[model samples]
Each structure stands twice: as C-alpha cells, then as structure tokens.
Target: MGAPDFEFRADLLDQSNEIVLVLDPDTGEIVYGNATAMDVLGYDEEDLLGTSITTVTGFDDVESWAEHLPQDEDADHRGENEFVRSDGERIPVEASVSRTTRDGEDYIVVLVRDITERKERESELRRQKERFEQLFETAGTIMVVLDEEGFIERINDRGSKRLGYERGELVGEHWFETVVPDDVEPEVQSIFEGITTGERGGVDGHTNYVETKDGTRRFVQWHNTPIHEGDEVVGILSSGIDITERKRNEDELERYESFVKSAKDVILSIDDDGFFSYVSPASNSVLGYDPDDLRGTSALDYVHPEEKSEAESGLRSTVDGDGDDVTREFRFQRSDGTWIWVEAICTGCRGGGSDDVGIAILRDITERKEYERELAHQRDALEVLNEVVRHDIRNQLQLVTAYAGMLEGDLEGENQEYAATIRESGQNAIEVTRTARDLAATMIADERVASISLRHAVESPLEQVRSAYSDAVFVVDGAIPDVAVAADEMLESVFRNLLQNAVQHNDKAVPRVEISATVDDVATVHVADNGPGVREDMKDDVFGAGETGLKSDSTGLGLYLVNTLVDRYGGTVHVRDNDPDGAIFDIELPLAE
Candidate 1:
C-alpha cells in the first residue's frame, strides 16, 4: 500500500482520535497509517511508509506480531504493552487488533490508546501496598491480620513473640482457639464474626485478656479495623499492647482505697504548699467534715488559734523532709466550730514527677485531755482544803481542850465532871480534824491506789488506837498476814479508823477488840469489837458521810474515809455482827502483783 492509493480513505481515518494502522499480516509491514498515527508516534508519512509494524509497537519481530493478531476473521483481541516513541521514550498503551480482508487482500487493523495516567495510578497503588506490608511486619506492638473466617492470615514478629511462639508458628491458626483465653473465647469470636459481616463496627482500645503459650493470661488493649474490598468487609486488622503490669498496679491501688474508706481515723494528704490534696472517706466520721470540703483548702485553717503555729511548723517539717515524720498534738476546729484535741502523725511521701506530699493520720484525744484537766483541778482544790484543816481548825480545838482542862482542875463535884467532859470532847474534835485532813490529802492524790504491805499498815494504826484507849482490851487473834494489798498511803488510815470505831463506840465498861487477817487470793482484815452490835437495817448506811454511830454531833469522816479509800482501791468493806455481841468490820483488798 502506498500513500497515494490511500488518499480517498485518509479523510475518514484521520477523523478518528485513535492511532489507526493497517498492516499486512504475512509480511509484518505497515500498509497504511492514519494522521493520528503520524502525530502520536512523532513520525512523517515518508518515515512510516513501508516501515515494519515492529518498529513502533512493542513486538519482537514479524512472527510475534502475527501471533497476537486474530486467527479467525472478524474476531478482535485486546492487550496492553508499551509503545516506543520517536524520541525513544516508552508510554504504556492498549491495543485492539482484528483481521479483515479488504479487496480480497488479508490485512490487520489496529487501534492504539494512551494509558499513561491509568498506569501511574496502578503504580501508586502497588507502592502503597508495599508500604503497608512493611509497616505491618515491623510494628513495635502486636499486629495481626485475620481473614473473614477468623483465621490468622498474618501475624507480625511482635505478635508472635508476645504470645510466646516462634515466627510463623501461629499463621493459618484459628485466632480465638489459639490465643484468646477460654473464658473469653466465645465473646471474642462473636465480635469477630460481627466485624467481618459489617454488623458491628471496628473496635478501638477494647480491653481483654489473651492466653500465652505458657497458659498464663496477659491483659491486652486492642485497636481493630475492618479490611474492606470495595463495599464488602473481607477481614480485620488488629493492633494491641500488653497492659498486664498496669492492670496489676490498678488492682493494688483499689485495695488501698478500700482500706482508707473503712479506717476509723482520719487519713489525709497535703501537698508541698500545705494545701489539702486528698482526704479519705473517714474524714466525715472523725473530723465532722466531708472529703470534698477539705480538698484544695489550706489544712491549717482548721487548727485552733492557740495551736496553729505548732501545727504549721510540724506540717512544714514533714513536707520539706526536714523531719520526714513527726507526731504532735493540736486542737483542731471541727465543722461545728468546736475545738477538739487531736494527735496527728504526719509523714512525708513522694510520687513520680510530682511535688512532695505529706500524709497525716489524725486520732481524736479530746476525752483524755479533759480527764487530765479535771485531775489537775482536783489537786489544787485539795491543797487549799488541807491547809485550812491542818492549821486553823486543829489549833482552835487545841485551845478549847486546854481551857477545859484548867477549869476542871479548879472546879468540884458535878461542875468539875462537866469540865472534864468538855475537855474530852475538845480532844475528840482535834482527832476528827486530823482524820479530815488525811482524807482530803488522799482524795487529791494522782494515784490513790498502790501496793502497800498489809501488816505494816495494820500495825501502826493498831498501836495508836491501843494508846488512845488504854481502858479497852485489844487482842490480836492471829499473826497479821505478810502480804501486799492494793491500797495507797491511805491504807493506814483505813485500819486506824476501824480500830478507833471499835473502842470508841463500845457499850461495855472495858472494851474488848480483836484484829486478825486471813490471806487467800485477796487480803481480808477483820476488826471485831465487843461493843453494842450494829442493827442489821443500818449496816449499809453506817459508812455514810455524817452517820456517826450513837453520836449525832460527831463528824463521821473516819468510816466514810475508809469506805471511799477501799472503794477506790477496788476493794469491799462491810459491817457484820461479831461472833459474840459486837460488830465486825471486814476489809477485803486485792493482792497487788
């Protein structure tokens, strides 16, 4: 075919946009070329005429070109290959070829299209796939790609190592059966099925446990995404991190919080700036303040005015690490604006990447403080009473006795007898004053009960009573017990009062008194007198403050003092009828160790 013979069809062939070519299938020679072919291939009519088709198309030779052509008449074939331009640059092109017989000559028709943009898109997609594969294989955390059937299609090195398996050991395995714990396998399989079917969305940061090869469970936080092919989800891609240690720490923190909630004392924390940071639930019960009321407020604001300076100093020492730990007492103001004594133990603490904090445990001691104050007041009042009784009262009674003795010496008959009676009464008044002073001193003592020898306590008071009542016959029925009793220095006062009561209230012309003691778990002292026996009805109140037996004017402090001292020492005293005709005063005291 020559250019001049093709002039009539050139107008129709040139109107098409494609590079149209006519070739002789047997010789692989270009029979005709259109205007589009000349323009796209960058060739002229003289350069393309009689040119072999292999010169421009990506075909090795005439046979290869004929092999791609349709073997049957009117049948077309489509293929892609690069086209070599005049400048030697290759651009991808798609070609459709068919064989036809025109004017009874066998020839091939070819339509060529530029596919450079489409090829560029395909190349970009290939590059992106390669990048994704690289990232999936080398990621720092566990990465797994699962097929729609929940099979492990691929797993990264990190995922294999975390599950305690060698590389490639877990591939092609069912994900739930191989790694998911038995307890959670059912739930995990259900979720996986939902994701693959697009019934459920991808899960992000979902926490669960996975079983390792060694049968131990590790807590995992996972992120999952659905792999979509067009509009259908074909698989799931998952990434996860091992959070086992973090879960353990969270459990321990929860236990400590439980302890703080149930504690009896107030537990609180303050920051380095002396502001409250955390307060436990116990604060409401111990300090009458809710936890929220104290947080972010200055702790010193609750201290009593007189104790604020000391409390602030102690807080500073703890937060600054100067003292680290200190226990001090301060009066803290309650929510109701009342001050209460509290003993606070503050200790310094430090946390990661934060300022120092001070932890304080506060115990209320208001009752103890009040008891101490009452004791001190009692001591002061007792001291003043002791001064008045020991000096002024005893001195006045002494002068009355001296004047009555003088008058008895100068008088006669009934008048002198009356003077003698007045002198004896004055002497008794002086003795009563002595007993009252001893009782007052005992009441004010810090410890009114102590271990004292029972024999020593009984002997001194017995001798004193024997001298005062020379007319009375005092006998010891048995040896005094050489044991200790729980009584104070006032123990002697107890026996003295009993011995004098035995002799003074006797109705017999000569009073007979007997003292004996029997030791068992406790020391029992018995003082018996041959006096008018006490009535059974009055036995309980005989030790009343003013119940002097047979004498209304007498100050009945002796037996009353005995009762008070015995009771304070955790002992018992009672009066009963003696074996013959008198009263027996029995004193029972605990034996001190």
Candidate 2:
C-alpha cells in the first residue's frame, strides 16, 4: 500500500477537476491518469494508464515531451498543444509538466486547461485590427498621428500630397518646426504642450495655417482626439479638412444673413400674383413648414374666411406694391390647420430685384389680444350695472322717501301708520345697496385662505348681530369648541349672514337665536333660532341665488353669500329642524390637523 501521506495526496488528485497525468520520464509512457484525464480523452482510466502520451496529444511524441528533460533536470515545463480524443476530435489546451519521483522511479506529472475561449477572442482581435488598418489608409480625409513628444509618427497618402510632401518625409518631425506656418506655430505648440502636461483636453475645429513645399499655405480646421495608454494620453489622432474657400464666403455673408435668420418675428415676402417669393428660415418652427415649401403657394390660402376683409387688398399689395405699411391683426392658419392670431406689419418692400413684391413681418400677439377683448367685455357689463345701481334704483328709492314724508304730514292717527311702513321699506332698500356693495367686494377679492379659529368667527358675528337687534335674545353656548377650520377673515361674514337672517325673519316678539359648536374630525357650528322654520321642500331653495323668503326689500343674497363663503372654504352648510321649533343653520368645516 502507498504511504499514508501519498494516499491522501492521491485522493486529492482524483477529486480535482484539472486533467492530471503521470508519465515515465525515460519512456514517456503514461503510468497513471486521473478522472479528469479519462473524461477529457474519452477513454477508460485503465486504457489511459498504460497508453503513450502521444496517443492523446497528437501534436507531440515521447521524445518531444522529454526534449527539455536533459537540459533542465528538475525544472517545470509548459506549452500550448492540441489534445486528440478517442472519438477522433481535437481540442486546444495549455499544459504544464514537472518532474517527479516515487519509489525511485523517474516520472513526469502534467496538468492542462482548455483554452478554446481565449483562442477565439484572440482571433476576433486580429480581424478588428485588419479592418481598422484598411479604413485608416483608404479614408479621403487628411489623417495625422502624433506621439507623446509632439512628433509626427504617421500621415496618410492624401495628407502628404495636400502639404506638398513626399510620403514619409515628415515622419519623426515636430509639428511646430516642419508643418505649421510661422503665424500659428506658437499657438499650436502651446496646445500640444498643454495636452502633454494634462492641463487641457482634446479639441475640435482648431483652424491653423499649414505650409506647402511650394511656399504657399492653406487654412485647415482639425479635430484632435487623444489616444490613451490606460488613463494617460500617449498620442493624438487628427482628422482635418481644408476650409480656405469656405471662410472667404462666410466673411461676405455672415453679418446680414445671420441677422435675417435669427430675427424674432418671422418675415416673408410675396411676389407678383400673390405667390410666396421668400420665407425666412424661421418658418420651420413658426409655421411648421420648410421654407422651400411656401415658395410658390399663395398667401390668402392661410387667411381665415371670417377675417377675409383685407384679403384682396393684402394680396394686391403683395403683387403690385400698391399699399403703404399697415398694421393689422388676423387669424393665420397653421400647418396643423389650427388658427393662430398674429399681428402682421405689411409694407411695400419694393425696388430690389422684384418691383411687385411686398414684405410682411408677423409677430404673435394671441395672449395680449385675448386679454384686451376680455377687458372690453367687462367694461361694457360694468356700464350697465352702474346705470341700474346709480340711476334706476336711486330714483325709485328717492320717490319712496318723498311719498312717505308727504303722507306722514297729511294723515293722522292709525292712517299715518302707512307712512311708517313706507319709510321702513325705503330703509330696507338702502340696506340692499349696502349689502350688494359688500357682496361685490367679497366676490372680487381673491384672498388667501387657511385654518382659522372657529370660536372667533362665530363670536364676532354674534356680538355684531346682537347690537343691531337689541330686542332679540342671542344665546351662544359656552360649549363652542376652541377649534380651527380651513377659512379666511371672510368667515365672520358667513356667521353674520346666518345669524342676521335668523333674527330678521323671526315672527316672535323677542327673537331667540342659539349658537353652539363641536370639534371632531371636522368642526361643526349650529346656529338655531326659535322662529318660523323653513319647509323641507323650500330648504334648498332658501339658499338659491335670488331667494328672498317673506322679505320684500331683500336682495336675496344674504343666505346665498353664506352658502358660497362656506363652500369656498372647503366646508358645508345646510338647514335642519331645531330641537323644538325654528330653523337650524348647521355648518361643517374641515378641522386643521
């Protein structure tokens, strides 16, 4: 039996996933094979044990495996080779061999790993290199390669001819000394130095002058890309084009052409017969059409039908240059067939090439026009309301006051009581105008709302109403909670309206009004009155926009104002039956968390 440690080592070798082999060094014959070796070779372990190493690795024979044995007796051996399987298939592998001895027998141990994936990756890399080389040489653009020292390492065929140099003449030469003209060499050298020192990045559209062999120079715009070795810039790749002629044309047209294209208002000119002659580049965004598409289209095609009064005049002016500059608003049709309100300033842009063409500069005025129209409508409505409140209502109230005063002087005893009724009716009419003014102010004032004290809202209104009607008994239960509700300062008016309506409509000799509040998830206030209550059928109608219940001189806006104010504060108000009699104004408001 093998020694205990050798047996332990043998167990480890059998369980290992690596292919293991033992060969007699002298004969180069396999003496032992591990499980992995048999599995890879597609042979039984017993068959593999006695076979020659050449039987599996067809690329080598016994002498080849032992070739290094004599030179380095105890050294490790490694090589790349192909393994031939029993099923007539070959696989690539990397093998490591070392000399070993057991029981005085010289032997070799080998371990191998499959390298198919690594070989495939290497093949793909080779093909990509070939493709890059082909494109680099054949591309029409001028190409130059510079090393970290700012020396030209390579330049393609097209670049050499452009600079009037034989191929390879400029290789190994510094860019500043050999190629760049004197006027721009200093700047070129500074950029290269900055790139080498890591102070600047790669650049594009760097225009500079380059000298030719004939002593003339051309302007070239170049884009430089830094080549990196890991994270460090080691070289630079540049592609350039000659822009000598392009720069000349740009100098002539840059000033005025740039302004015409970037103008805020879209400018278009129409030729004779009312066909579009020139449309600014801005038409792409303003009208969603390419400028060329409107070149021959008529201008009236986009005018709205209802706004065609100036259509014939505008078209004739564009064709004959007959009209002076006129500013007017019109609805022009957009590409999506929607109408856009635009104010066009049309003028006779005549005497340049086409004598019959007219120019129009259209500026968008949709928002301003809409606001002006809305304000005009509001002013008209206000004029009518002033006529009613200041003239019509005033005259009628004056007549009532005059008649009541005269009746009081002419009558005597119980007949004069009619004058008191008439005088009271005039006073009520005055109160209506005052309430109307207050309601108008409230409706128009947009105030910010927040959680405010409900107790204060009810108490302030209750005290005011008591002072107005001293004969009425106003009872505010101390049980009202010190809670907050989502509302604004207008909350007092809400309570004032409900309380005043309760006492004002009361039939009792002494009106009794009770006020109480509770706080839960919502704060609720109940203003109850001991008087005639609202019927179920008329409960909702009592809060209608024009509801005046049993009161002839009322504006019918008191209860309506109460309900509207409560609703605007995110609260609810409704009438319910009081405990024994009368109406109850129950209000619910959201409680502040």
Per-residue lDDT of candidate 1, residues 68-158 (tens digit): 8899786999989888888888889999998877776778888898888889999998999999889888888899999999899989998
Best by TM-score: 1
Model 2, span 464-552: residue lDDT tens: 87886789998878767888888888888888888878887887889899988888888989989988888889987888878866554
**Number of colliding residue pairs in model 1:** 0
For candidate 1, what is the TM-score?
Answer: 0.58
Which residue pairs of candidate 1 clash? none
Candidate 2 global TM-score: 0.42
* C-alpha lDDT of all candidate models, in order: 0.87, 0.78
Estimate TM-scores for all models. 0.58, 0.42
